[model samples]
Target chain A: MDSTIIIEKSVIIVAVFALTMLMAMYSTWAERKVAAWLQDRVGPNRAGPFGLFQPLADGLKLFSKEEFEPNTPNRFLFFVGPAIAMSTALMTSAVIPWGDRLHLFGRDILLQATDLNIGLLYFFGVVSVGVYGIMIGGWASNNKFSLIGAVRAASQMVSYEIAMGLSIIALLMMTGTLSLREISMQQAGMNWNIFYQPLSFIIFLICAFAEANRTPFDLAECETELIGGYHTEYSSMKMGFYLFAEYANMFISSTILAVLFFGGYNYPGMSWAVENWGVNIANVLGFGALFIKLCGFIFFFMWVRWTIPRFRYDQLMHLGWRILIPLAIVNIIITGTVILRADIAAYFGF
Target chain B: MSTVLIIFCVLAAITLATAFLTIFSRNPIHSAIYLVICFFSIAGHYLLLNAQFLAIVHVIVYSGAIMILFLFTIMLMNLNEEREVHRPRITRVGAIVSFCLICLVLIAIFINSKPIVGEYVTTGEDYQSIKVLGKILLNEYMVPFEFVSILLLVAMIGTVLLSKKEKLQK
Candidate 1:
């Protein structure tokens, strides 16, 4: 209720909005560049200084192009489809801890949109809502291919989210907190969780890849089969919204993976920096550390996209239910036994 | 008169309205979208409860993952408005009546309980953080945690079996 908190929250919201828009912009360029590099060809060299402005150009093109809606009976639902995708994509960033606190003008700035106690849960909830956009877009398109693509994407996402949730459970148990800020704090001064819970981290990494719907898990939009997947019938900016949402999801999920498992906003000798450089400078450095971690995960996403082949539907389901879910459960059990041994002994009167 | 109270009222109204519409909408796809709106509104309610964790889980589970399954089923079955089977008038009336009774009972129970509201305590430690939730699951609720694992396994097997079609050769 304090003015300072309100100001801090507003600043964070603005920053996250700016960050999401910027990431969505760059991801378009990045996807193209990655595709180009993989095929051993130069890409988008002319747009604006090494194709940096390609996303801008693409946006302009989409806007200029006439919006096309098929002769679907439900006009209201048709428009709602892309709006759902774009809004839900932006909503997930609400809980991401972009940085540690930075002191400015005698007021401490929290470098996140909203530091809810249930930050991870908030992320999961937002990510889940993301499905509506795709489903709506596909269903409203009134095309068989679009409908099929929607079906495929919906199934793929739901199957993988279970694995993703289970994977996080192991790390959550290890860190003993859900607030991303607290998780980041616990990972300070070289006590990164990846060292302690590598299995959980790996499973999380895989689930992250799947959740993003990148290559190998991109059955939703396989150009060969689904003809551009869920957005097949979409044209112009409506189409752009769907694609942009995908990248936004990718960027947010990457940031999450960094924060949760890779010592978000923490680095070696962070204490030394705080002691020497003061709280503001140290926190800035921590933010830089988080940014670096996020970029690494994003690059990993891109790397896997370029390298791997798509998973067959049956194979994808098999991995989710049979492999990833079970492994995640085992990881949770192991984490439980190790952390709760004392409590277990006490409970048994040992 | 508090901002919190006002926000809660708005969110609660939106949640209940959308939830009511979710079941009432003749078109299943429309019902799905309304359900999504309902989930989001519930997430807002969760925010009010200070159960940010549970709210997010609710969004992720009900809105994101579970709704996707519903969407897939709807699409795969091609249950558009044209193919949608309308409910019989008598059955529809019964459903509405039963729903009203359920709501009335729930409201009555809630009003009668007058649950003592706790003061908002800023626990220096976030007890419900994902990490803490994990710790509690492993340490305190370890048995239920294991049970959930078996539950998922059974669910997985059941889904595969249910979806499988018997071939003429078999």
Candidate 2:
């Protein structure tokens, strides 16, 4: 409630926003570069030194392109679609714990923008709302392909969300808290959730891929089938916003994955580092650790995208509903049993 | 008056306006969108009361899951185009009569329960936090909660049955 606290939070929010946008922008370049490397071709060396500034060039091109609007009845929704996508894509970072804390100007600064107790639910809520962008855009365009794409996206996201939520429940059973910061702290050092809840991690990873609409599961935007999918009618920076929102969603998903399963900002010898190197240095290294993990997940996303083929609509539905949901439920049952094993043993007089 | 009061008033205004817009919107998709906004404002009201868990769950359920389904149905039905359907005079009269009856019943209930409601009081207790809510749900409201789950399961089964492909008849 203090003015300084307000100022501090505002600074953190701005920094996180800039960081998210920067990461999303560069991810486009990285995706191209990685695709090229995998396919054995030169990606974008002409733009600026191995195409380091390719995303910037791409941004310029998108910005300068002629804005095109379809002859649709719902002009307002057409505009609202991309705006909603872009904003919701950027909103998920508000609850993520980017780092432990920083000692600066005689104050301990938390790296996250806000630490809501129900951070996990907030993430799910925002993600669920994200489907509207695609649905509204596709419908507003009044194109058949766009409408099909939007319907596919809505169904895919909704179906996958159940499994995703179930998988997270297993992890939640282990953590006993919904705050991402507490989850990060629980994974201090090499004590990651992945070690204990590997099944949960795998299910969560698959669901993350599905939720982000990334390949192997990107049926929503299956270009060959849906012809650019939901954003087929979009052009100029409006189209760019949809693409940027995808990358931003990918980046946020990777961050969530890293923070939940991987030891987020928690290196193996973090205690030793904190003891010897001091809090500031150790926390910086922790932040660096988190960065490395997220980047690794991002690269993994792109790697899978290039390597694997997309799923058929039926197959996607089957995997989500039949396989993933049942698996997640089993994982939850297993986790509950393990956690309460001692109680069960005591009750059984063993 | 206070910051909380101001926020409550703003949220209330949004909730009311969006609710009316949802009902009055010509396009089904627009109506769905307005309903989403209305749901969000109601969630905001929950947040205003410091019920963060309830607010987020409200968002995830109503705005996120249920409304997406609503929009999906609306979109699939292709209700974006304006269409006029003739209604019988009897149907309109019946609707109006039922609406008035419902309103009268609601008002009567509110008036009758006014004394029991008394005044708003803050207990300053950890009653609405997720941990406490979970405990209360599992312990105190355990039977009703289980019944709700059973009801949902039955509905899910019924939906599957209703949607399942019929067998070929000779």
Candidate 3:
């Protein structure tokens, strides 16, 4: 690659990295703020306006704390668990299309890091592997609570993953492509998919909540039952990594939700802006629009977390296997029938 | 081209080493983890071959889902290194013999086949794309595909039946 192209890619990679880190960091502050607001209390206002620097303070505190590892035989795997968790959290951003391509310096640069042909599958693959982090960490801790938490997390993720994949299949049938970039592009000009595939969107949203281990679905880390759950034995930055990875996952999940169901970066007068303003301006606006959508979804995640109580463990499993799975299957059949309505009509002599 | 070769060599080495570890590791959890590493290496090889669809699916199905279940089961059973019972001498001998025979057959097949000694040229546009794969699977392998789905449904029903606890009415 030419030096200019290399420089362009480096800049984009750095920007995406910074954006993901920034979003995750701020999500902690946002969560606490939202939670406090809902309970009618002042949330951290000691550091900067509205506790803007609260995340930084929290990071410093975590870093300063002592790191604790249990007396487990598998020392190596214990160390590797959080590293896996952190890396996998960052990895999913590679395939997400942040915005349409930006035209600048007489060359077009795709906003995504790399759009693999199998973007959707790559997403699920990375997400499914994320379970290893919790499993290894909890197992290596050699504590019953941690192990129980890990097992709960693993089974919960596995169950929700089926429903998640099934729900996506319905959306895939409607979109007819696996690449997230293609899906976003197809939903251009105010044709956001949520209008067409509302059931798929609802199922996907619920599954996403479970996959991210947010409240209501966070049976693995229920404080009263599991006593800190999977990260019970973790302290210092190790615990910070687990918490950070969850927020990072939530951010990515929100971005995925927006790109899949919402119009992504496609705005109502995008064509007008491209004609009047310019490609670069339009793309920048589109990026901002996408960011706004992501923030909205992130807010929704926190809102639900504060509003809803945690589900009991058995109830969680029942919802996953007995309810969501069957509902998702029906959604798929309905989506398929609707898509091929003309053929079905012809077969029935409509 | 040289970079791809280097990556492929690294992946192949890891795949072989991990497969051996998976077979020989005394700790069941460690063995499961080694098998996951082996699966990931194989997926890397799939990527090198430009089979993106197969690579991701291999990861999701094998390393992600199957191995997690394996690790979960090992943990649930509370299997530890100290409690692992040794195999009989005859079983060890038999295993060695079968392993050697498999290696010999693999070598024989390798020697008879044309060796790939040149630059890799990947041709065709979107040959492994989702649309192409879906079309081929539905049209060409439709029977087997449907059979697999039905088989999975039956397995699910069997699991529910087996695990269901009957009410002990007094």
DockQ of each candidate relative to the true complex: 0.65, 0.81, 0.81
Model 1: per-residue lDDT, tens digit, A216-274?
88888888988888788778998888888888888888888888878888888888988
Candidate 2 segments exceeding 4 Å error:
A346-350, B80-123, B165-170
C-alpha RMSD over true interface residues, each candidate? 1.8, 0.6, 0.6
Top of the candidates by TM-score: 2
Grade the docking of candidate 3: high
Q: What is the TM-score of each candidate against the true structure?
A: 0.86, 0.93, 0.91
Model 3 compared with the native: what TM-score? 0.91
When 2 and 3 are scored with TM-score, the better candidate is 2
**Residues A115-141 of candidate 3: C-alpha lDDT, one tens digit per residue:** 888899999999999999999999998
The i-RMS of candidate 3 is: 0.6
Chain B structural similarity (TM-score) per candidate: 0.70, 0.76, 0.71
What value does the lDDT take at residue B105 in candidate 2? 95
lDDT of each: 0.81, 0.91, 0.91
- 2 against 3, candidate with superior lDDT: 2
By the TM-score metric, which is better: model 1 or model 3?
3
TM value for model 2 = 0.93
